[model samples]
Target: MSTVDLGDVDRFTVAALGPVGQRTFLLQCRSEQTVLTLKVEKQQVAVLAEYLGRLLRDLPRPGHLPEDLEVEEPVEPHWVVGTMGVSYDAELDRIVLIAEELVPEDEEGDAARFTVTREQAAAFAVRATRLVEAGRPPCPLCGGPIDPSGHACPRTNGHRPPTN
Candidate 1:
């Protein structure tokens, strides 16, 4: 399998497109001349943010996080992400993010590896959390999204209509 090593990324962030109920999440990163975008699920973004937040807590606080954390235009994803992992490099004081492309079990998929500064990591975590929270509100009883059309909450056994 081929792997794209985007060493020392300059920009990294997660973004969502479209409305709350019908949105597409993307994990985008850039290192100098190269830019990579990957399709990701909302749950993945949420979990990644949570994981990074926890990891950052154990490390020293970052100073002067990046502010222009917006998704670059023409968000053409290279591939749909299957699995992702992150780790810290103590010597370099950076965070490494690894993402593998989704593929059938019998086939091999490409992978991407990148490293970002602690400041970039912190910015990404905060921005990703905000992007995930911008989605449709979850149902109180079932914790499922309350779609604008309607949500047949399984908790109530379809007995009541959605309130929001």
Candidate 2:
């Protein structure tokens, strides 16, 4: 297996291309000289954002905080992520992302590991929260997403369709 270690990254963010309902989500990390993009599921992005927010909230403040954070879409993805792991690195004061690449049975898989600062983690969490909330509104009755066309609310028993 191969590994892409981007130690002390400059930027990291989750982004989606296209509309919320029909979007392709990505986890992107970059340094001054390198950029790495990985395909990820929307649900994974949402969960990571939520969990990262909670994690950062519980940790002590770092010595330095980023003034601003930016999210940029890469030209192409290096690999699609099959699984991912996130953790805090106290020694480096960074948030680590370990993304395992998806590969065929005969081929060896690669892992992309990167570290972003605490400030970047906070920014990522905020952006992720916004991205998740930007999706279609939830049905009041069934709690399912209310699509632009319509929604079949379980509570209605097929009698009436929920309005967008």
lDDT of 2 by residue, 86-124 (tens): 998877777888999888878889898888877888878
- Model 1, 37-120: lDDT tens per residue? 999999999999999999999999999999998889659899999999999999999898999999999999999999998899
User: CA lDDT of each candidate?
Assistant: 0.92, 0.81
State the number of backbone clashes in model 1.
0
Residue 126, candidate 2: alpha-carbon lDDT: 79
Top candidate on lDDT is 1
Judged by lDDT against the true structure, how good is candidate 1? 0.92
Q: Give the per-residue Cα lDDT of candidate 1 at 118.
A: 86
Regions more than 4 Å wrong, model 2: 62-73, 103-108, 140-143, 154-157
What TM-score would candidate 2 get against the native? Answer: 0.83
